[model samples]
Target: MTTKANFPAAAGSVVVPYGHVVGNEKWRGSEIAQRLQGKIKLIFEDGLGLVDFHLSNRICILYISEADLVAGDDFKRRLVRFRNANSLGGIVIVERTQISDQYFIAVQKLVVLELGMVLLPVANQGEASQLITQLVREQSKDHNSNPFLRKQCSQLLEASVFRTVQQIPGVGKTKALLLLQQFGSIHRLCNASVKELELVVGQTVAQQIHTFLCS
Candidate 1:
């Protein structure tokens, strides 16, 4: 119902403040929107276009009701149009009631594989609200708090670098350590001249290292 140009700034870049969500005007009093009000800050805006909800600047949601699924391929067309028009990561939330369960697999394949977007199934709007709340909570947390996003410490990085250096032909722990001391990273080690490498290992091994890396 809304157009892309009506957005505040960039396309698909809905700047939602922390612990808040921007919802489409179409869902002003919908059950999911109503439920979300108690859990997080829900702000209604017009011209959200294909997005039903904006979780963050980079993430958004497109809701497909059970009726939409049963109606025909209109939901698919809507998803395709959204994919073509927006750069934001879309999360498709579909109502998966017993009646709509039959179409779940087909919908999943279309939304996930073909469209390359996330597809989440909910029994009803209540469940959808709960899932959305969890998603917003996760998004609000510090990235380090998430196990998948926790940064690899320098010690682990150095160990990984150490192992990678040993993979070079004819280089073992001692030589790997020597080369690492001379060249702090694999990029520098790969770029080292034979004369440069000779400063770390002997001239004979240096040539071998240079050839192994370059060739």
Candidate 2:
């Protein structure tokens, strides 16, 4: 829904702290650098670094391979600070591989779901770059249109309501919130017929919800 002009021009306008590319070059260098060369700012630092991918001004992504979870406490701390910050754009953790049950559980409870950040498992570096670019462009759009950022910024009560409605297939945060605003509750929203929902939302979304409920 956003225009290309709204997207980051080159290497996103952010700067990665120095040393972010030094020791971890194997996982963090070359391909990642090329993808982000003109897409984000890769800063040089004399001190220790925190995040591996700085996609935008508000959101920074941390990388975790299957083997690197245990030694990432510093990043955990930065994530906490970012979570508590007033800035709306939240953290996104990009896990490079399929991790163990314990690692997944630890990340889910300690950071991802609890701290209000997104954790995505990407198969390769190329996918990671493309995904980050997509997210960055989406974040640049209006708040009403950027569902991910909207959900991230929402309060508990509203978030719960949105999540409930979003469970319907093809129902994103915007449409879910709109449906709730129109119908008042999930019971009422679900009870509405396709025609009734179409009157409020659109043909596509109404059909999607109807199909989902009926299926």
Candidate 3:
């Protein structure tokens, strides 16, 4: 069993190699660990402090069982302690069976809003195993592969900006394009004088643009 003293408490210091998960030794025979078999590589380590699983060097998961909710307050303290002790991103996996449904809202507020950690509820260990597998896969994927992380096309960005400029009252596509060509960007256009804007658009449209931006 690996003791707490064997490793640093700072989760960022722990290096989780690709395509693997480090689980707490206590979970070695647990349903979650068992179900995770053949899905991804799982390695057990002792005294991982308050974390139940390490998905990566920067992210660790804390499992809260139905019994933990029933028992009350103890799990809250553990979460707070983990937050205080480590700089890693903590994902709270909660078992939300019918018996534990009542505590969901309160747990959500504390784990997500108060503690600023992610809280994901699962029906059981099997569900948790599946979720963990997906999370691991997502973490392993290249940043560019995620649509949200990918660089947007320049043409799409220019069209979007053109549309935004057109949304101003009294401004149409011709004036919007003229304004963009003069100013180069929304920020410069917003900061432009009514007189400067009149160079591209008329006095009325320039005042309208100024009012829309400033007011």
Candidate 4:
């Protein structure tokens, strides 16, 4: 997945979990890890083995392959771990092969919506690597912004009801669902008073969503 990339490291950078360093020639962790090594802070394990990588200040990115997605309940648990974690940037699903309907539906229902996962499925590892590098660069570009490519956000908005909720201005899936639950439906949420919405999703997001619905 190695390719030419230009990223500038700044004050807040990525924190790679575990001791798994990106290999030089082999590039075992894929080109994304290799390219991001110096640009990001690679936190080698301190005898406490953790997950693949950790973006403490940045959003969490998970490298999910179709094979991994179909790997029974064990892999499902792994996916759960990533989804439950704090501040997820995106989940890059590498499709070396076709993902079956059964697994695909499960992923959509179980992980994407419920956890507000920003899902991006790439054709191969190369695309995944490039996209990941781009995300890192975008994060570097604007420190106080959501560092998602325009295309990524568009795809997410089109994916499903859950994703659409996640795209409502500052409305993440969790807060969106909470407001929906309180109001009983999306239509109700749109019609809900700002004070009512604020009780569920907070003042800023509530106002943003009310404005969004009106617009």
Candidate 5:
């Protein structure tokens, strides 16, 4: 069995290579280097700013904060599309120093963590890459240690109820498992009332699940 310590670590310190771009000559070399000082610069070019960061051997990091300038809704939609399409390993939002909103603050924090870049709080592309590499290493450790967890994960994959529970408003896979584990069967779970389900899976999810199952 693969152990946690056997997980591969990210590259330590390597001199980044120079990149080629067609239209942007002035933005090359030291100018781009200055913008990417602390990061392990994988690729940087001026025209359209095609920057790719080394998140891990299997994953790469990409940022779309610049995309936000196009259209807030469109940017968010495109960001999701890009992430889904490109298999973007993580996401980070860099604020423009001028705007400050509590709503965005919360969102920023949530996105950073969800993308596995908790260490890169401010969301610099370089830092986000490094954080993602670290997260991959940590997740590798978690993946190795818990065989029972893996078995449960595989069982969930085969069971449509796992996916169905996630689609319901407030119920996630975790709560779904808790419900199944406690009830010992989905039939029992379906029979559980809103109040009884609430005791196992939180009131909000329980109520939603009750409506879903009863309906």
Candidate 6:
């Protein structure tokens, strides 16, 4: 069976796992590996070899395991080695069994070293495949959206309202926006009496704003 690693790199590189293979569970492994291979270029090997291969490829590693996972000093050492050897994009460790806190901590440290994140309790190969596909789709959408443009617009809109509200001592951004929306203009909002403001900004805030403006 082809592994997820066999699938083409989604961006520059990605690492997928063959998962766990208990005795006589070769079929499961083969099946997952085949499905992955059909999608990308894959490398199939034991856990130790998988680690080594990730270092060599300089790609993100997706580790699939069902056995008890313990990330001890040895694993940390390997992570350090991998980091030094390759431009480690990310590390996603998928566990078949319930993970222990100790194991999670150890893996988390490895991720920190590699600048990666851990994905927990993946359940099975199918689930892992689905997760990867969804991630790719989301990433693609973000790429298409021109993050800088979106961020700039959001920042400008926030700053405009924030600065405007700050001029009115007791009116915060929310109250200010509520007043503006309800009255259709800041000038109209200022013209409103406390009783009129209360309908939109609530009684407590309206009182505060009236006191500030009257002062």
Alpha-carbon lDDT, every model: 0.74, 0.53, 0.75, 0.52, 0.42, 0.46
lDDT of 3 at 90: 75
Residue-pair clashes per prediction, in order, are 0, 10, 0, 2, 0, 15
Which pairs, if any, clash in model 4? Answer: 17-53, 60-89
Tell me the tens digit of each residue's lDDT in model 5 across 135-184: 33443454435243234323432363444445556767887678768887
lDDT of 4 by residue, 1-215 (tens): 22332221221243333222221222335555655565544333222111343343344445656667667666567666655554444453535456544465445544454555555657666676566556556645544544444445445534554555666779777876776568764456657889988888889988997886666
Between candidates 1 and 2, the one scoring higher on lDDT is: 1
TM-score of each: 0.62, 0.44, 0.63, 0.48, 0.36, 0.37
The most accurate candidate by lDDT is 3
Candidate 3: lDDT over CA atoms? Answer: 0.75
- Residue 126, candidate 1: C-alpha displacement in angstroms: 0.4
Considering lDDT, where higher is better, how would the candidates rank from best to worst? 3, 1, 2, 4, 6, 5
* Shift of residue 144 alpha carbon in model 5, Å: 18
Per-residue lDDT tens digits for candidate 1, residues 45-160, read 77777888887776788999999999999999999999998877777888989999888767765665356566667899999999888877766676434331112223333564
- At residue 42, candidate 4 shows an lDDT of 38
Q: Where is the poorest 10-residue window by lDDT in model 2? A: 1-10
Question: What TM value does model 5 have?
Answer: 0.36
Mark the 10 consecutive residues where model 6 has the least summed lDDT. Answer: 18-27
| Stretch of 10 with least lDDT, candidate 4 | 17-26
Q: What is the RMSD, in Å, between candidate 6 and the native fold over all Cα?
A: 15.8
- Residue-level lDDT of model 6, residues 64-172, one tens digit each, is 4554355435555555555555544434545545554436533542343123333334676666555443333333355444353234324433444334444465666
Off by over 4 Å in 4: 1-51, 85-96, 99-102, 144-215
